[model samples]
Target: MQLLLAHVTGIQLSVRGVWELLRTHGWSCRQPARRAIERSEAAVAGWIKETWPSAKPLPRRSGPGSSSRTRPLSR
Candidate 1:
């Protein structure tokens, strides 16, 4: 992507060259979410529900105020 743009614009850069540039500039690729080894799925869900707008994001015009979204529990 960026390498393509650079090459077309006469910058002359390869994928490896871009990688080297990033490394030299002390930049790193994005990383995944870091979770504890002893993560509790139920606890995480509970936390999300309790802390997320208090719940999930409800669709628009679902009958409610804008304070937060009330998510219906799925069976």
Candidate 2:
């Protein structure tokens, strides 16, 4: 945001200056409420238990096929 301010207004501000500006506008920082009031914890846990395995990354292969090279290995 400070970078944006400097980019748009040709003014650079220290971190404290940004905080002061936010406070002047009545913006106080607090932990975001990540969970909805109507969300069910049991439902969330059940979904994770039942569905998360499919969403996880594929198991990585090793040995000859697992080389991180983009092109064919040189002869």
Candidate 3:
């Protein structure tokens, strides 16, 4: 509202009013993701078991110290 107030000369709009207008226009409120509705549980489970492991694979520790850049550069 602070940013919007600057653009208008005298119009007053509250956060509640803005949300009401968005709702009236068939807009969803606070939907972070829609996958829970469209995606199936079995498919998600399968991906987690198969594709997810490869997609976000655990770090290949080149024997522990090799992966740690925070250690002394010479060490």
Candidate 4:
């Protein structure tokens, strides 16, 4: 963000200065969402169709199942 600001406006600002400027203008930072740039739709579809059914079932029947909360929720 700081580098982009500097490139576009030709004004280099420090990290603190940039945050302060944004805060004064009611701007807030948000995390950028991640995406798989090199993902292949065909490969993923093939894997899901071919490998998913063969995958072992989760949590064997003999194993301890799920646990309940120690305390109940309060209204």
- In the range 1-75, model 1's lDDT, one tens digit per residue, is 566768677786778887887789888897857978999999988887788874666877655445445865444
Residue runs of model 2 more than 4 Å from their true location after superposition: 1-31, 65-75
- Ranked by lDDT, the better of candidates 1 and 3 is 1
Residues 1-75, candidate 2, lDDT per residue (tens digit)? 899999999999999999999999988898766867999999999999999988999998664652666877553
After TM-score superposition, what is the CA distance of residue 9 in candidate 1 from its true location, in Å? 6.5
How many residue-pair clashes does candidate 2 contain?
0
What are the runs in model 4 whose C-alpha is more than 4 Å off?
30-75
Whole-model alpha-carbon lDDT for candidate 4: 0.84
Clashing pairs in 4: none
Per-model lDDT:
0.75, 0.88, 0.70, 0.84
Candidate 3 vs candidate 4, TM-score winner: 4
Could you give candidate 4's per-residue lDDT for residues 1-75 as a string of tens digits? 799999999999999989998999988887657758998999999999999878957865574444667855454
Query: Clashing residue pairs, candidate 3?
Result: none
Candidate 2 Cα deviation (angstroms), residue 14: 23
RMSD of 4: 11.3
The runs of at least 3 residues in candidate 3 whose Cα sits more than 4 Å from the true structure, single-residue gaps closed, are 1-29, 32-38, 60-72
Model 3 TM-score, all chains together: 0.34
Better of 2 and 4 by TM-score: 2
Better of 1 and 4 by TM-score: 4
Candidate 1: Cα lDDT at 23: 89
